[model samples]
Target: MNGSMTDTKPDTKPHSPVLIGLAVMLVAFNLRPAITSVGPLLTGIVAETGLSATGAAALTTLPVLCLGLGGALGPAAIRRLGVDAGILAGIAAVLVGLLLRGFGGLPALFAGAAVAGLGIGLAGVLLPALVKRDFSRQAGRATGLYTMALCVGAGAGTGLTVPFEHALGQGWAAALALWSLPALVAVFAWAPFAKARPAAAASVARRPAPSLWREPLAWQVAGFMGLQSSLAYIQFGWLPAVLQGRGLDALDAGYLAAVAAIAQAPGALLLPTAAARARDQRGWIVGGLAAMVAAFLTLAFGPEILTVPAAIVLGFASGGCFGLGLTVIVLRARDAAGAGALSAMAQGFGYALASLGPFGFGLAHQATGGWGLPALLFSAIAVAGAICGLGAGRAQQVGQAARGP
Candidate 1:
């Protein structure tokens, strides 16, 4: 549990922290668009492809499942590619997957989603480690910035894809494909760091950290991560469709989703910093979960006039929840290696658990022929997430004394 394996040596002429932060944000920007873009366009994809409800659910679920699988690969990627190269590789995969999804037929679309999910999984898991490694002094703030960028990206993907589709005159595929451009930019921005050697590489090689798989706190963190993520991905994959079913036009629903997503930016930016400064994050976690549940209820049954406000509230609350969830990972770990390991466990198991939310929502809607069941389901998830957060929000480091055999 010592910090030797995670400490970086002071660089004689170090890269500016601001520049590194910018690079991290840029990479983070590419993470959500691949999945978010699909939600706003789901109706069209289902219509054009003649997909059944189940098939469409699978379309959204596949990438999220891949995210978990990819997260499981993060430690291996760090060992083989180093953090920088690992990120570069992840972005490249995203770019390719976006392109493939945009241009191909049904089979190609699913294939592309899997590829992109893998990339997202890999990059998502590694980014926290990079933040822990380079920004240990300001991990909370740094997590906020990147998490904000991620929210912005999610907003853009939801907001802009519709506009892009209309402008391109081709369809949803073209709009989805356009997301690859950001991935291309991220790859270039991150390439310089790919070759830079991490100072702790030697230390990491000499000492293996304890396994976190059996740690109760690690499981608590992972549960918090997965359950919150279940809500988040449900929003990403279904909120717009839910709005459309409420009689809004596709464009309006998409914009509302964008508003919710963009609203998260400020919350993502501010909450983690506040939580990090607090004695414990439990209050923040409970408040965020409460807000999210309220927003979900409002969106599900509130008046039409209240829709925008609900979206904004949902976005802000969800952003806070997500940013704090990630902040806990860093706060709970003793070092960068531990952060990487905890992140992988949380995201790997967490996202896999998350994929069920959207799929289950689709199934619930299909089974009941109403949003009531789905609304109840959302409430159940938020309540469960809160329980896990209460445990994870404690001031303690994981894997220090509770390592798995």
Candidate 2:
């Protein structure tokens, strides 16, 4: 493993662990809503904006694309600004994006999503490193907590957007804009913790992160991140729409999506903690992929009675897979700088690759005019994720791949 970070002083200072932990949870909570909320509201947005199905897909695709692009900038920002400042900036961007989205118009909607996605990307990479740095002794548990927060946030976004729209007398823009409240709260909530960590910025700046782009294991991890993320984003962007095509109305479709999303919370809370204590995470990875495949298959051809249960299974597996991906980033790194680099590398390339999932689903649907084709494609994605996740889930670190016999 890279040893360059050893010289930096440890951060055991002004901020209590509770404050930092709360900040992490709040920030994690902000990452998904700005993006996930759009999916449930897509039908309304498309109707009002007159966007084609593919163009509407861009509402989801653009942010995900920005997520990859923005993640690439995280390490550099942290290198210059420190973790706290970097995160603060990220939260600010999210707030700004939400405001832009809420303001109205299609251009504003896309632009806002892009901006928020950039913020999410920056925040995403930093959170893992923060956990690795501050809660090293309980990285798994801490990660699980924050991961659960992420799920809850995503679940709320999926489940609540329709209701929010209804409550606002079917005001889609109003609903989309209101999600800013939580992100605004996150910014204030993160401030005290950021203020307490002035020294951490200096320490992190002193460490030179190694180049991970050349490492094969790093690519494996990136592949795992990308593949699983593709599935998750698909769920985020298209699951409701897919279900709606089956005969459900907007609210019923939203509820089904919510059930799937909320189901993820348990696995997000438990799997990473369990995986961290294990000798290897391969079994969890495989199990999660298996569940995704099953979910897809059921959605594709099973009886309607099985669909809801399958969605629950898919959510549970997805949460475990995603949580494990976050855990591996920390577990495979030797220090915060290393974790930051790995997180950037994984999320950067990974999300860039994943951004295509939603758009592709849209294209497949547009082409075949049904969910059958896309469901098969989703199964294919699950198989690919399993292969990559199996490698990423191994009991090894990224830098160690170079030194191995």
Candidate 3:
């Protein structure tokens, strides 16, 4: 059992870590495009489909729920197939989902979004564990690479989907479908790495069973993940609309949202690397949450002139917290198995909790007929997230915290 859990090291033969990392990066790059692309084009979708605002919100919310469900199932997939195979399967699912969403009408769109979200959920759960296993010595760097890739993909989707729709002259459907190309590319890029793993390593890659559900630290980590994700998804699903309400056009709204998403890139790349070297990440977590709260206030009632800067600040804060959330999952684990279990806990339940953000935010806006209430709510959430992060950002490992003397 010990050997199986701890023996996931790469084959003795010289295999290029660079190649595997690139494969991982490509796969990561495909994770967010399906969801992000829909947001910028949501106005056209609602206009064409006659879907209500609440219904349009489902485009973002449903996929996130599926992502949580997928993450919950990721451990099983990883156990059944090694990391490479599991992630490869996920990337393929995403491609199929994108195709379904792009070609079909409203029903197919929602279904495809859910399917793609599931794929992202499964692969997303295992990514941290893969870094912990294969790049143990440089887990921070590997995480930064993939997370940065995620930010780039998200930014591309937010920034380009509208233009793609205009360029293709095919409406939102074509724009949504265009994302499948990247997923297809990821699948091809990942296949070789998945196949290169030695047969012997497959048996050894099985994670050891750990009762992470019983751990308080694990729950704190999950709360942090869910809360931060909630804020992120809210921005994805509604930022353009909010900006439009504030007098910006759809194109400019999307560009600003793109700026916010792109801003996360630097934070995602830098925070994990920085936190990995720190004895405790509490200070970083606190500071990031502080920025989030400040940004929320500025967005809610501050002068309109400050919205751009507020969005940028919010992006940095959310991005830093997100990267730190993943980093703690790795830092809190003793081994790959532990990391896998922690990831399952953090991402699975975390996203389940997160799925409500966009949906509820939409409902609140509908009820209040404005963004004020939701903005205040988000500020409170940031505070709660900080509290959770404080506990999760502790220096000790999950097992150690759980097995208290």
Candidate 4:
């Protein structure tokens, strides 16, 4: 396939919107499982991998950082491959990377994680565009479905990792490796779309990605996205271990952690729709921050017995807050290109910020005698998230819309 996107029209492509949408969703479901599933099984991996504290934490952060990198680079990648082929390549890369991380040991784990991150990053940038492209009339409803699927995937990955680890009594290696199966499933599910789209016959030079760093709204959107993402990644990376430290058995802690994550699917599914229907969402931002503060306070000062409900409430709010944060990106953008740039900006900052969560939580917990200080500190981060969200959620456009050349 060799030509420029400027020289071709995606309109004449043979695929239907349903086909593209489903393909995008299947790819979305695969993106998180590898990066996310390992957290619930982190203890076993640390023991098996002989990782130091930093190495243990890097398992989570490296992928997150790569997610950011992937988002930043995905647009250029798309220009080279065109949209449909680029997606297929990303899906394949993640599948291979998942296997490498799972079966190959620590170095391979890092490599696999990085590769998987790249795959996810590409998919992340591309899918949002596809949503804007194929589902222009249904962006709100479409985002809800896609975001719901994101939660379901995250939760399932978190839940299954430990169960699989416990299953063969083989520790975390096999459990961690098991996540690759879904990517394989996605590759097959998405095969039809790749088949339908004909690649261009001549290659073209990739254009420089437009700069987004100078935009004020870009920063605000990124800040809001990053702050919520930091908290969510904390849950993905450490909440299971946190609950276990409080005395639940492995299985009990896993389910409780799963309980915390389960609410995310619904919250992500519903919150953006609610926010989109309103003119001002500053109230919801403040409320989400407040709920998270309450949740952390429960973890810090409330009885240990309340961990279950605390986890659920916090998890629910995290997803909802994030869903609205994502909504803010699309709503504020002036065009599909603007939306695309903002998405990259937000995710690049968001995932890098997210990479901090697990490592910070782990270190703070390690340094202190208990979870209290870390919870308090994270409470501050959550508060910051609220402040940023409120600002970002305000009604506004990306910038002055450009007149045609």
Candidate 5:
């Protein structure tokens, strides 16, 4: 077994673990909204500033791309600062980026987004490992809550942005910047992590992270993550635009995107819980991923009438895949460190590579001048996710695949 993931005996002894769990969920809930909230509002910002199509796309693509790079570095950052402190730093980074964007114009918009992505990406990787460390016996349940919270954050970001903008009479920039408030709240809410004495967490650092990148299962997991993520990021980045391509207005496009965004919460809560109860994750992995494929197929082949339900199914199914994928990383590993390593390996490359989905879809739209065929591009990516997820879902320890030199 991977040294880092060695499962400890569950402590049945009572303690109020729910408070800590809630705090962690709150943190999870804030992770994605800032990143996703901007996507639906992209056109408004672009139109006001006269940003090019490439510039508008970069706002979305850059954050996800940086998520990949930041995932690789998160493990090291947590080791240096402790999980709580690392999260605080990440929160602060995102806030700064948010403020930059609020200041208006192109330079701040792109530069701030890249910086904020780095912060979100780091926090994103750190959270799951921390969950395993804190709630060992209930990794599945904890991950379910965490993933659910994440979906809620995503949905809120997509669902609320335009309304928030209009309500405050602040325009999209000011409304977009308001998302940073949650980051600040997250930083304060996690102050307990900073209180962890140095000696208290010394054990976490000494037990070296497992060699996850070298493991075949690790690669398989990362591949599933990236492949499905390519589909997801495309939705976050282009679904509204794709809908608009179908003869919908901008407001109509945003509402359609909202349907997909809101669907994620239930999937995040349900699928991972189911996967955890099973003997092998392969069935859940294959089946849940297939649901994602079906969602895309409905969109591709069906007429406009199918748009609403298709978005909902696609959103829920993808969130389920994410929750299941993350659970597989935690359950298949032996400990917190193993979970951390898996998180890093899977998300780092997964998201970086996944950024191509939106880029390709946008490029295809530009090249082909329509969304009809470009939507098919994502359908193909979903099929690839199924293959990768099935392999990673096997009940094998990531550490069992290799030896130390």
Candidate 6:
């Protein structure tokens, strides 16, 4: 593991950096729409499908669980398919999943979500490695761009689906299906790179790396990633429902969710650069988590007029936490191989842990017949994330101290 952590290799083929960056962003753009699109439409889904709160939660949780499954499988998948081809495969799965989701039934919806989650898992794991491999000199900046695209994509899905539904008069299913078009675009954009088979493919395949399960720093990072992600996914899966419960209409709730997602762009674009320049990331992580907790509480329980403001704050704070989360994965690694290993460990274990948030939230709401218990759950997650961030934010590369003398 230590040996793999330090190995560095150069790419044989010189591609245009601008083009590669564009392709990376385009791929990132497709990662979130499928998931975000569902939240705003959840009410209608439950109405038509006759699903209880628990069942609805399961509908949302399935994809996230698959994300973990996909992430855990990412290393082996990359080894076999190589990075470019792996990402291409992931996007193709997403395209199929999106189309499947539009087929109008619970079976199709769950199946599509599961398949898309797997693709998201695979692509999400590889992207950091790609940035670390190709943009080694400016990884922080590249990460920001990647994260920004994710926010924009999420915002588009959250904000646009209802409008699309109303405009086309094709119901929620068709609105959900429209996101597939972007996935299709991503497929073509990423295909050329897969064909080229960049050196990153060979480099990762040649390396024999150990698991990060035993590393303390790795666990801290994963803990923080999981906890924060739980909060983020809860927002993606339930915020609109929560808002609608507060007396807002579906369109208003959807717009609020979109506002939160779009607002993430600035924080996502800026926090990584700032964190990279700082002495240590602990302060940033701690501060972001604190802000996140406050914003969430405000958004959920505060006066109705303050809802938008709270969401904006929540978005910035959450984006900062997320941006810092991905940044630390890169910063705490010695090389691209280490980044990939840490990413898989953090995201795989992390997302698996995160899958519980929405499930628990639903159960809490169902059990209590109110949002109070779920609000408490969200607060607890934020506090736990801050605690983990304290350890993860320390300036130490994972596995360095774990290596034998």
Flag clash pairs in model 2: none
lDDT of 6 by residue, 292-348 (tens): 888888877899888989999888877778888888888888777788888888899
Tens-place lDDT digits, model 4, residues 37-98:
87777777777668877677777788888888887875666566655666787888889888
**In model 4, what are the clashing residue pairs, if there are any?**
2-201, 2-202, 2-203, 3-202, 3-203
Local error of candidate 6 at residue 256 (angstroms): 0.8
Q: Tens digit of lDDT per residue, candidate 2, span 114-171?
A: 9999999998988888777777778788888899888888889999988988898747
lDDT of 1 by residue, 290-361 (tens): 999899788878998899999999999999999999999999988778888899999999999999999999
Q: Candidate 4 at 376: error in angstroms?
A: 2.1
TM-score of each: 0.95, 0.95, 0.95, 0.89, 0.92, 0.95
Clashing pairs in 5: 5-334, 5-335, 6-334
Instruction: Tell me the TM-score of model 1.
Output: 0.95
* Quality of model 6 by C-alpha lDDT: 0.85
Higher-lDDT candidate of 5 and 6: 6
| Descending-lDDT candidate ranking | 1, 6, 2, 3, 5, 4
Q: Distance (Å) between predicted and true CA of 155, model 3?
A: 0.7
Model 6, position 397: C-alpha lDDT score: 83
Model 2 vs truth, CA RMSD: 3.0
Per-residue lDDT of model 3, residues 79-196, tens digit only:
7887778888888999999999877599899989989999999889988877877777877777877888888888888989999988999888888999999899999998876776
Worst 10 residues of 5 by lDDT: 1-10
Q: Give the alpha-carbon lDDT of every model.
A: 0.87, 0.84, 0.83, 0.72, 0.76, 0.85
Candidate 1 Cα errors over 4 Å, as ranges: 1-13, 198-207, 400-405
